[model samples]
Target: MTRPKSTSAHVQPTLAQLRALIAVVDAGGFGEAAAELNVSQSSLSEAVGKLEDLTGRPLLRRSARGTVPTPAGLRAVGHARSAVQAAGDVLLAAQDDSQLSGVLRVSSFRSGATYLLPPVLVAFRQQHPAVTVKLLDGDRAGAGEQLLRSGQADLALIEGVSAVDLSLTPLLMDDYLFIAPESRGTQPVTVQELAESPLLLSPRGDACFQRIETYLGRLGIDTSSATEFEQDSVTLGMVRHGLGITLMPRLALLPVPDGLVLLPLPEPLSRPLAVATLPWRARLPLIQAFTAALVASLGSASGQTTPLALPVWNQSPKLEPEARG
Candidate 1:
């Protein structure tokens, strides 16, 4: 009685298999990988050997201490992670239904996803725990476009006063506040006054800062002296440590992170938050569910009778075809 070969040929590598490979290398032995994977040692060895044979490279070496990947194996791990993530994306996509069972792939910045999305996502999970949610991080201008362009994600939450492509819904209305250390004092700092003082900003080329720049220019101040940070969360962190001040949305406020105050922007400096999606995504049920959850969360947080509505991701109504002059 011969044992049957266990690897699937017709399909791309399954997440379980890739993860098992990763486990074998990370754990340093087939036995440990099996234990971690909750399978028998024999099964783990066969699976890993199958993976090794399939890739045509020696992925692991049995050493005195434990297991580790060869040079080729290390590269394999990186590819395996991406394959596993893509597989996970597929699994999430397949689960799409009223239950939001599929994966809800969302791309946003560090602060936007961490602070702005939790309440909505929390509510969404409660409504449909079976649905897998993947929140990716990207910049306001770039991240949203990445989700739509990569076809890996279905929706995006971009915070800014400007518009992107024609396929975006403008969910406007957020007053970008100048947050600073409590030591900066209780009085609200004017944008000009703050800009002159080594302002900490949320990255260059950020749509949020662009809007702020135009608004500040009206007040006769130039922000060329401003300093920017890559991570949205870090920008806030620097302010907390007395680095400088930054502007962010109201939803980005949660427990205030200590030693910081979300001061109201000077009047008339308020900005809009936009939600963009692929035009075809108008029909995605999971996207719709997340949108509903987002509105509900924002309404509850702001204490407003009407929550901001999700924008139409289809071509923007603001854009019109130009005359062929």
Candidate 2:
């Protein structure tokens, strides 16, 4: 009788080995891939060698120019990339199922973070107590730019301006309100009337100032004579003391001072507020959770009768006042 044919056991490649192969292929050299993987060149080479031995094929060819993947290596690297991404997904899912502990870095302008984020953050903390939310505040343009360029912040809340290569989700449209001393009466202020009033305006280079100028320019109103203040608080204080009338977004009027009167602009104009993130970063569960919390908080704050939809530009929802005794 003929003996049964002998067969060798199949060898499986470890995740580290697959990662080494992929890194080498992408980085185009052993040295760079080793540095990226935070492993010694010898260790990375050994891992790739083991993978090659298991598969019985040469994966990479070293040259004077750089490392190049063999035909088989190219195919293996493709599948290796998918495997590595799958492994990361598994880890992220495990973290989410657990306590979800980690810092969620957020970038936003001072007004957005201070006036808008507090209530949302309070609710977020209650849901994920183990997660810490860190805030980095700056100007709107700078904050959003830094978040994308540096990859330091997971999310950014900023004005709805078109940022190339970044994804923007409009959350709300805040109307510009005419704030005047209570003595001016509660009557709605017309844009034409604003042309004659002594306006306390933000500095010329400010985004708010630019928006206001653009809006007024469309209405044939000239505000070149308006006095410029560097700080919103200073401008608001001047309005409080009856210095001059000022225009501010409704969201910025949080904790509206006792004696100031807020009137809707005769021709209503609103600035869009949006949340931004890199396309890749948006897929993270932690980022998704924070964004969901923000959306829910906005819905609760608005008390709208209709269902809230994203990119809600036309709905001017009323913001509930902070509790006062």
Question: What digit string (tens of lDDT, one per residue) describes model 1 on residues 1-325?
Answer: 1234336566455566688887787678887778887889887777767776667667787677888888878888877865765555554456546656656678776556776787777788889888788887666656677556545457777765444441555544754566777677656567566646667766558766777777777877677888887766787788889877777655454435667766666665655565667665544567767776776676666555665532212121111223332
Regions of candidate 1 where Cα sits further than 4 Å from its true position? 1-100, 160-172, 181-184, 188-192, 231-244, 260-262, 309-325
lDDT of each: 0.66, 0.75
CA RMSD (A), model 2: 11.2
lDDT of 1 at 219: 75
TM-scores of the candidates in the order shown: 0.57, 0.64
Model 1, position 139: C-alpha lDDT score: 65
Query: Candidate 1, overall lDDT?
Result: 0.66
